[model samples]
Target: MKDTATPRFRFIDHTSDLGVVLYGKNLEELFQNAALTMLTIMLGDIPELTGEPATINISVSGTDLSDLMVCWLGEILFLSEAEGIAPCTIEIKSVSPTLLEAELRTVSVDPSSIIREIKAVTYHEIKVEKRDDHWEAKVVFDV
Candidate 1:
């Protein structure tokens, strides 16, 4: 078990790739935290969007919890790398064992603020589990 008393997500230092541990009281919050973590990593600064941020819907499906996390974060990465968007906020509207749907509020990225480019979201040491009353996930990115 890891610390769960403070922020919902925290970055983990990795020798090569980027990593984060996400905590949530439910699946919705878990996914939301995951998205935020990825955005924070990509943007370097937490974005505060105002005046007509772009809104988009995202959906992904996977076979299990760990797979779901990868797919979910992968979509977020796609929005950044391919679509030139950095998410300001994520609202996980619905989630189930194998599927997720969310609304993202985003803004165009500032290329210089991107600390490092995330090549992909990897399966390395991915874990999603319930501990006490909340769920936690550990994810590593191929940067």
Candidate 2:
């Protein structure tokens, strides 16, 4: 497929919250982009997050793709907020509407690098859909 997951995300203004729209060629790319976008929101443009890489194996599931996205991103948040780890990249091993497995390259999350605290990934306005030639996801974060 054409690699359409390149562009990252666009900011969506929310009242007392953070939001974004994510794109990808497929579900794997879409989920990967979602993690990256969440990272950006949490830490800003932290090029230094590329520090020594560590790997994490993850398997998450939900009732559907949208709920699965929430589970996926929720893991990303747990790594960052609870474990103090920041994922720099993701290699999605496999994905279906209800399940996803991936290996993530990670680094320690520096407390000082945090620009915003996302309370949670909200369900409000969350969407994942294939728009003609590519996939699109709209996600809102609770702040």
- Candidate-wise lDDT, in order: 0.85, 0.86
Predict model 1's lDDT versus the native: 0.85
For all predictions, the C-alpha RMSD in Å is 2.3, 2.2
Clashing pairs in 2: none
Q: State candidate 2's TM-score.
A: 0.90
lDDT of 1 by residue, 14-79 (tens): 998888899888999898888887777777665788778999988899999899999999998887
For candidate 2, the 10 contiguous residues with the lowest summed lDDT are 43-52
Best by TM-score: 2
Per-candidate TM equals 0.89, 0.90
Q: Which regions of candidate 1 deviate over 4 angstroms?
A: 1-5
